[model samples]
Target: MTDSFQKRLNFDGNIDEVIERAANNYSLGNLKHSELMTVGLQDYNLHIITNQGEYVIKVFSKLRNVENIRRYVEIIKAALNAGVHHPSMLKDMKGEFIHTDEPSGLSMIVLEYIRGKTFYDMDRAPNSKELKLIAAETVKINKIKFKPSYLFDSWAVPNIHWMYKQVNKFLDDEGKNLAKTALSWYEALPIKLLPTCFVQGDIIKTNVVLGENSQIYIIDFAVSNIYPRVQELAVMSSNLMDNKKAPLLRRVERVKQAYLAAGGELTEVELKSLYNYAVCAVAMEFMGSYHERYVIGETADEISYWMQLGRQGLKEGLGEK
Candidate 1:
């Protein structure tokens, strides 16, 4: 097994024991078979097959703040009511979505297993139709009015400056130059004047799953927060436009048009700043992944992938392509 997989398996206690305790909190019948999903870097996701049905138990890292998890749950509930196709959070025996295992001091939540394949699982870019569906769903999420009390998220687009500061020193000279260019464009945007809303901040391919009947489900709201609404399209653009087979500008326009059709209104300032924000989003991912790989010692190959995309996004945004 690769080091990345080993890192994912490196939990504190017995895996079966932890699953049993967490599953006991739910009314889901006996856990027939459970497998650790090697998906995300931060959380330990278990694809558990219960006699009642299928469900996902997300065991959050100790580093995650409980308050943030609570806020994420609230945002998800609101998003669901607004017709966003997100997996339903399952309430535990105590009528709460978050269940704390007293022994491990780890917080876990059960969600209805989305029966589909994430773009990551397919290892391909979302097609134009899928991109439009993603844009429409994002509009539904941004339309949510309930804002969490905590609005400061390191991964939010507005915080790119802060993230840049944290990761620039670790970046090489070429990486630094690309990041600086993206930052310069980001700095020129009228961020304060742009419309703000609760955005599904991370709209990357991995967080989007193509479900049965072509329904698209957005998962993993760990980075969602209130931000300039345009950041939604920006994040989507950065991820979707990475495909070299299609013209980047065409993909960008498609998502923008879809968002507008789905009741999203972008101001003139936001329109001009969209590309800049998308580039900054790429820089953020690059730097953040660099930090994880170099500083935190994560051996995931995704760091190099982000670096490659960051180079492309920065050059394209600067008209250097």
Candidate 2:
């Protein structure tokens, strides 16, 4: 009840100015060129070319404090030590992981540009071997140990539930009723069957990079948190297996088997709850995000697309499709 919290930075400003300042901070003599790479609903990523090398500059649109950046830096550093492959965080000229522009209130981070193909770009859905590789890599990420921050505990295990409540407030009567039913179904599941651990919450196919020598690199730790490890599996399965063209449950089983083969553990009950968790998780995401866009008075077209997808996915999960 504190506030409707969304993770994205709703930042809009002069990127040319930001890049200029970042060049100074990172001690890059000159910015050879920079371009707006992709604008997702949540983030604006830029492909930056500097005198030294190519880099990806991320400017969070929403306002996140220095402390939040520090925590992510801590987590990333720990992940590195855990033998998890990821792009290195490029330090600023001042040796800081975070750069804050006082006037713009934008927090930026520079990452070494990684060259690789994501699973999304693959010509076809991943075969069993590739799926196993992804699962094994995920296990390696979950193995990293870190002390939990008290302030962050609120967003970890129950993030989906929290999102559902916030989004429920913005839904029409029918939407609210459907969400209630889904939440009721999800809440009744045996989610507590597995213990909590540090999970890289967003371990979907897109965040993975298959690099030279078949090295697997995981990126984007913005939403990683400590949670029931099965929730991690549930979320990832939901992400990778919800395609209508493919055999959803069967493909998910393969992924689950791959995960287990990689020394990942889960209870049967937890496994059975995957779809319910997935439905709620997906619903929570689109609902909260759509509501945010609505409140901000931004164009609803993109969010509407996701809202439709979420609703359809929920219906399918409920065997209504």
Candidates' RMSD to native: 2.3, 4.8
Please identify model 1 stretches exceeding 4 Å from their true place: 1-11
lDDT of 1 at 37: 77
Stretches of candidate 2 off by over 4 Å are 1-13, 39-43, 101-105, 117-125, 150-157, 169-174, 210-215, 296-305
Q: For this target, which candidate reaches the highest lDDT against the unseen true structure?
A: 1
**Shift of residue 107 alpha carbon in model 2, Å:** 3.3
Worst 10 residues of 2 by lDDT: 1-10
Clashing pairs in 2: 9-61, 9-62, 10-61, 10-62, 11-61, 25-93
lDDT of each: 0.77, 0.66
- lDDT by residue (25-101, candidate 1, tens digit) is 88888989998777666677889998899999888765568787787688788888898998888988999989988
lDDT per residue as tens, model 2, 114-135: 7767664552445676677778
Which candidate number maximizes TM-score? 1
Clash totals for all models, in order?
Answer: 0, 6
Q: How do all models score by TM-score?
A: 0.91, 0.81
